[model samples]
Target: MSAALPHAPARALNNLVTQGWNQLARVYNSPVLQRVAYQPPQDEIIEQLRIAGIRRIADVGCGTGILASRIQQELAPDLIYGCDASVGMLRQAQARSDQVRWINRQAENLGLDDGAVDAVVSTHAFHFFDHAPALTEFHRILSPGGLLAIVLNNPRSRFARLLQPTMVQGLAYFPPPDEMRTLVEAAGFRITEQRPVRRPIPDQLVPDILTVARRG
Candidate 1:
C-alpha cells in the first residue's frame, strides 16, 4: 500500500502540483516534450478507447487537450469533456478546439453526474492525484461496464526508484503494477489489461504503464 500523507503535507503537495502544472501549461504541448513523453502512448490509448466502443468520454487531467482533440477527430466520440485543475492548462486546452467541453475541475471532484460517461482516459497525470479518492471518483462517474485507461510513470530501476521520492516531494506517487492492480480493483473495477507503453527509445529509467479496467 502507498503511504498516506498527513493533512498538511497532502495540501502542500496539491498546491505544488497545481502550481507547477499551471506554470508549465504554455510550453507543455511543445513538440520536444510530446515526442519524449506524450506521443508514444497515444496510439495505444486511442486503440483501447476504440476497442471499448466509447461514445461519451471524459479526459481527466486532460492537460492542453491533445489526446482529447485527437479522440474528437479520430474516434469522433459523441461527447468529449476535457477536465483539468489548472486554469492555465485548461485555457490552453480550450484554445485547441471549441469542440471539447473544457471543465475546470480536479480529478477527485469531476462535477459530473453518476455514470455520466462511457469511458475515462487520463494519461501522464494520475501520479499527481490523490489515488484512492480519485479512483473512487472515477468509478462513481462511470457507468456499469464503463472503461477506464490510465497511463502513468511506474519506475522500476533502482536508480529511478531511488530518485522518485526526492523528485516529486510527495506530490506524486507512482505505484508499481501489482499495487496499481490492487488499487483499481479496490475501486470496484475489473482489470481488463495491463501493459507497458512502447516508447520510441527504450526508457527503463521511468517507464509508462497502461492500466485498463472496466467498472463492475
Candidate 2:
C-alpha cells in the first residue's frame, strides 16, 4: 500500500510559505511577489542597459543583490556598486572579488561624485522613496544620458484584490504610472520608457509590472 499526502496537511504547509512571504512582504519596503515574479526587476534592467550602451551601474536599495549579480555576468560593468539601508540584507548579497562594491547606506543621498555611474537601477523600490533624498542622489550619480530603470508592482490585479485588505491595503503605496513618470521627469530624467513586466502564476492570477526609464 502507498500513502498519499493529506489535503489539509498540504494546505497547512502551503499556508506556512504564504505566511512567510506575507510577513516578509510586510516588513519589506519593496514588493516581494513582484521581485520574484520574473527573475526579478534586475534582469530587465540589464537588458535595457545593453540596449542603451551602458557599461557601469549602481543598484540602489538592492535587496540581496539579485539584480547586481545579473548585471555583472551579462555586461561586466567596470564599476558596479550596490547600496541599501539594511545591513543584514547587504551582508547576504552575493559578493565575490571586485565584481561589486556593496555599501550600507540610504539610496536617496548617495555620497558619490557627480556623474559617477553610467546607470542607476532598482527593482520594486520606487515607492519606498517618498521622503528619502535618494531621487536627487540618483540624478547626481548618473552620467548624462545614463539609463535609469525602476520597477514597481502594479497592484491593479485580481490576485492582489483576493489577498484583499492584506497587500493592497497594508502597503504605503503611491499613485499610478502617470504620477511615477511625473516625479521622475521632475527629478531631471527624460523618462524614456515605461511598461509592465508581467509574470503570471497559474493559481494566483495577478501580473507584476516592471517599469523602466532613463536619466537625462
Q: Write the per-residue lDDT of candidate 1 for residues 1-216, one digit (tens) a residue.
A: 002211222244677787788799988988988988898777788998897788999999898899999999999999999888777677788878889888877798888999999899999888888899999999999989999999987766553666566356887777888999999999999999998898887767448899999999
Top candidate when judged by TM-score against the true structure: 1
User: Cα lDDT of all candidates, in order?
Assistant: 0.84, 0.63
Report the lDDT of model 1 for residue 89: 79
- Backbone clashes in model 1, listed as residue pairs: none
What would the TM-scores of all predictions be? Answer: 0.90, 0.73
Which RMSD does model 1 reach against the true structure? 6.0
Off by over 4 Å in 1: 1-12, 158-168
Please state the error at residue 126 of candidate 2 in Å. Answer: 1.9
